[model samples]
Target: MAAIALSVSTVKPLGDRVFIKVSESEEKTTGGIFLPDSAKEKPQVGEIVAVGPGKRHDNGTIHTIDVAIGDKVLYSKYAGTDIKLGTEEYVLLSEKDILAIVS
Candidate 1:
């Protein structure tokens, strides 16, 4: 029998954060107005792709994060650490930076 792969590549995050590839929103208005690429609004919500174990507090205790991979989350528009993978952009931020999880 041929073996089948069931898992994908995993990227582990360091410290108390995770890396996420933000999904791009539409660049056109409902009325058929085409907005330039530079005029697109940044999204405040995204899916979690990779996550850190947890963060250590000032008192030395580890505070585990609540968000996990594949979860949709809301965050601040200007928050998170931005990085580039190939031609795409991603964000690395702590779970604390996440505002809420979309049900």
Candidate 2:
């Protein structure tokens, strides 16, 4: 897919969604073996780059999302839409897909 460059100043999520800057996959192992681009495992942890306004409940209230910008989070490995902006990679996924906030 064509990569659309997103800047914090230019992009915003409309609901309980988040935009994450994906941590790079490891290039080399502790055993000193370098993996090819096609062989590396996808990283599930990343820093939240941007977040949406809270999700609105049916009772007419909004519950604030637990995550905020700069929070490092763990997500399901198969979750999120992969996107590339310039040379950097990012993931766009719902707040529910975020499994935990990493310290």
Candidate 3:
């Protein structure tokens, strides 16, 4: 099978979906102990990179997504599909999967 190249600029979500750049996981503990890659947990926080257009309602109205690109947001763990572009990690999630917008 032929492999297709993907870049952050090339990926776009359909409806009410968002693309987020995953934050780097902490490499050290408070006690100054370093963590191995196997010990690091997936970070639940990320910055929004791309967003889909508003979802269409049955009445033909659109409910726009509240979050915008560059907004830091906390999302549900295990939510969304994980995507890797080069060395950066990202996730594609529905707007509903986002828990809160971090200040």
RMSD of each: 6.4, 2.8, 1.0
Residue pairs of candidate 1 with colliding backbone atoms: none
Model 1 alpha-carbon drift over 4 Å, by segment: 1-10, 58-60
Number of backbone collisions per candidate: 0, 0, 0
Please give, for residues 5-97, the per-residue lDDT of candidate 1 as tens digits. 422244578778877778777779999999998889887778888888799889989888888889988888888887766666678887778
Write the residue-wise lDDT of candidate 2 on 1-51 in tens digits. Answer: 998656655778878989999998899999999999999999999999889
Give the per-residue lDDT digits (tens) of candidate 3, residues 34-83: 99999999999999999999799999998999999999999999999999
What's the TM-score of each model vs. the native? 0.78, 0.89, 0.95
TM-score of 2: 0.89
Write down the lDDT that model 2 would get.
0.89
Cα miss at 32, model 1 (Å)?
Answer: 2.2
Candidate 2 regions off by >4 Å? 1-5
Which candidate, 1 or 3, has the higher lDDT? 3
